[model samples]
Target: IMEYKRGSTLRRGQWTAFVFLLMIVHQCVGDIRYSITEEIKRGSVVGRFSQDLGIDVKTLSTRRPRIEFEGNTRYCDINQKTGDLIVNERMDREELCGQRPSCALLFDFFLENPLELHRVTLEIQDVNDNFPTFPNEVIKLEISESAIKGERFSIDEALDTDTGVNSVQGYTLSANEHFTLSVHTSADTGKYAEIVLEHELDREKQDELSLILTAYDGGKPQKSGTVVIQVRVLDANDNVPVFTQSIYKVSVPENATLGTAVVTVSASDADEGANGELTYEFSHISIKTKNTFSLDPKSGEIKIKTMIDFEDTSSFELRVKAKDGAGQAASCKVIVDVADINDNAPVILIKSLKSPLPENSPAGTEVALIYVQDRDSESNSKVRCSIEQNTYFKLSPSIKKHISLITAVELDRETQSEYNITLIATDEGYPPLSSFQTITLIVSDVNDNQPVFDEQSYSAYVTENNKPGSSLCYVTARDRDWRQNGTVVYSLLASDVDGDPLKNLFLLDSKTGVINLAGPIDYEEQPIYELRVLAKDGAGLVSYTKVLIDITDVNDNAPVILIKTLTNPIPENVAPRALWPWR
Candidate 1:
């Protein structure tokens, strides 16, 4: 079963159990491979991805199927809604794989939520888009008129970039009486043609020979290339130079310096004097070999002319020819193998990335797909990947040389919104080479925090009989979340004070949280008013705070006067006592 667990949950294990059943089909059926021809139209469906994986269509939103390429170029993409894997860009088999026999593009199909990976091999079939071509338009050779029958001369091979049957298969020589063609095939170097002398050459009768050599490929259209072979017959000389060895094998490090001696060739001639004396030169070598190495005609010494890089060309094969003063020649092949060195540093490629991740995302959420590449061979290319000093995120080994960056712990956007994660890759070479790539991760906010008031309760004093619609007191609240989730608004909760709604008596500003008097109040009617103010965030998370308003009395009532007794008649009658009753 393939499973990635950050913390612990039965849902994850259940998903793993589900995928484990699919793994049976995946392993038994081998890799999820698809074949498509070169230059396929973009958006063309390659295969049904989710159906092949036995994944449910309803869960595609959370699964988030995606494609991750091994190289920088992205050729295919997955459709989450339809479950179809479609071509993202046009592809050229010749441009992508060159002359490789099996042109397969290897990549991975990544599914999120449970974070499962399925390896996919996309085979790009070749097309007969190119014709067989020769390096040169004309091949020139010299031969002695006395050369006998059955003598063979080497011909430069034609090249075809297409692989398999589309490559050069055969050669045709224009009808000739003096010479015929002999085709040879090698496991290392494909097919090559040679010229064989069927009849003895006479310089007096024929001074020069011009023949046409045509090369054909096995393509459906059967395209071919043609070149002219010019043979110059010279006066007879009996001596023929022969090499000590037919083939020479040599090995040198790719870091070998220029002027480094690779090999030497020696030949002997049976004839004496001018006919026996021989000179050497390179013959029938490709442009790459000619530019890299040089040969000395006098000493017959071959030396490096330019630095050799194993990454570019691991080995080279060139032909060396020795000719006597009579123009009789013989040639041998020298194969130089270049050894590898740990010179290339590991490279980090981010195939797919999910940044600005929602802070509320689960622990096992896959953040990115990373791949490391080292151009060196064998142990030098083996690499170890890691994340530097990170606890919230960790690297999980995936399909060969690929790493999945996943959340190790739950994240809180309020604490840290941004993280700079550094990924380091180190190879297993003797003097280990290393490289690092830093990724910037952003944590998006969620409505996890509720609005909080500045104080638990508030107290304000207001005079009785104050003007209606006057400012009473202001209450403030703050939310920790960002953007719309952090926005807070205020309202007076519905409650009855003396069987009347508090909102009817007090007004709370939705934006500013300012409380205003809705109606007139008197100390005799209500001296103190108790109300609850509620704060809510944009996501509807709420908090409540109590507000107490004290009303002070004012001099608004006039003093009352009461006449206990009638003093008009008693004032005239009484003088000293002044205690007069009207009765």
Candidate 2:
């Protein structure tokens, strides 16, 4: 045997020989060549050293050594030439110590050394495990009547075990017209929803409402769940009351006693309960009386609380108010007329007056009469008259009961034309009412006057050729009576005052006092004459007077023929002697 240094020397020689053998083995395994087909299936592993050394690589031939990996770990790469596996770095030695490494560990080593290992093939399997849930299972919301359509209300939440689109995908509402929902995020940490009210709510019409909310997730198909929502409404006041009539009128008896009911008024309110209730009261009055009238608190019945006398009061005016329970009120006026009752007596203004005894007395004079008035029935109407001790005036008992007369004093125009006196009138009563009146008497002037002519005697002149109906001297008279009574008439009582009765010149105008010729006057037969005249009044009183008439001659009378004709001797031949004598 070669002398072997069994201690240090033998150790060195053994190291050298081991190194030499190790080099050879390294050279064979390290330089090993192998190729994975381009069409190699995932998770397929083969031993590269066994194929290169042409030896039964039993240890490495089973498949590629697998490394167990956990969450977020994977096989990063694999060596195609040597069939070396690469995996993530976090794999522990216990995972590698297993007789058959887990594929997860192989993925980890491949991922860890991805530069040395070029490729990795992993096949992760599916599992059915997680149930979908909501981030917040329930939601709450509020809305207003003023809210517009499609306004957003609030947001909701959901959760899911799966990720990506496999988590909560969308949301839905049962009452879509009233509300709506939409997904806010991509299932982040679970799922969430944004809810909105699709339509406005009117609290005045509806008080409360209900809604249903649902959330769905993306799975193989789809999955969904539901939530309930409750909503409440509030109230507001916005109404007014109306009346039936604008005004009311009533009539009541004047003698109606106190507390008598007159009439009732009313109004209406459309609201409910207290808001619609109405009441009545008096607002004003035309006549004020101390507690004389009142109204029913709720019914508005006008009543008389005190005595009403038509003798003193005729009508009453009242203003009434109708109020709702809401404190808003309206006012109206009512006229209450008090009917009349004839309970008063007539009174006299004048009691007595003096009597008048004149025929032509002026009007408005109290003469022989009494002023009487009745306060009772006509059967009780009685009046009497009497005159005090006076010789000139007397009262007649058997004649008119209230009349007096002028008896003893004879009315004479020469003595006195008027008389003013007094008389007394008395009625037949328990306390006979007596009154006195003054009477005025006037005596009228009778036709006892005689007409007096202007002169006792007068004269007039006339021409021989005076024509008939020619004016002569005028004769007039006077009387005491005025106008028609005092007027004097002219007439031929016996003969004309100028004594020309045969001369036909005795005509006169009674009213004008003018004398005129009744016919032609002949101066040869009655050159001068004496006449008589008469004057009278309508009362037939007459007076007489005389007048003298004198007639004068004029040349106008044709020359009473000393010679009937005269002739001119020389001019006879020229003009045939101017004229023939009258035959």
Q: What do the candidate models score in CA lDDT, each in turn?
A: 0.80, 0.50
* Best candidate according to lDDT: 1
RMSD of each: 7.6, 61.2
TM-score of each: 0.76, 0.26
Regions more than 4 Å wrong, model 1: 1-100, 104-168, 171-183, 188-240, 257-260, 274-291, 305-307, 321-331, 558-583
**Which ranges of candidate 2 are over 4 A from the true structure?**
1-403, 407-409, 412-446, 467-469, 482-487, 494-503, 552-583
Kindly list the per-residue Cα lDDT of model 2 for residues 1-583, writing each as its tens digit.
0111111110111000000111111000111122222223445453332343342444433433333222234433344444444232332322322111212211111111111111122322222123454433443333446556665544434444344455556777775456676656531123455556676778777756777767677767676666666555433223445657666777787668777888777777776776567777654222243156888877778788887765345556666666555444556667777764433222222212332234333432223322233332222234444556666555432111112243554444535666665665454444555556555655566666688877888888888777778888988788875456577887665543345444356676777867788877778666776766678787788898887778887766565648665564444355754654444
- Pairs that collide in candidate 1 are none
Worst-scoring 10-residue span by lDDT in model 1: 12-21
Q: What is candidate 1's TM-score against the reference?
A: 0.76
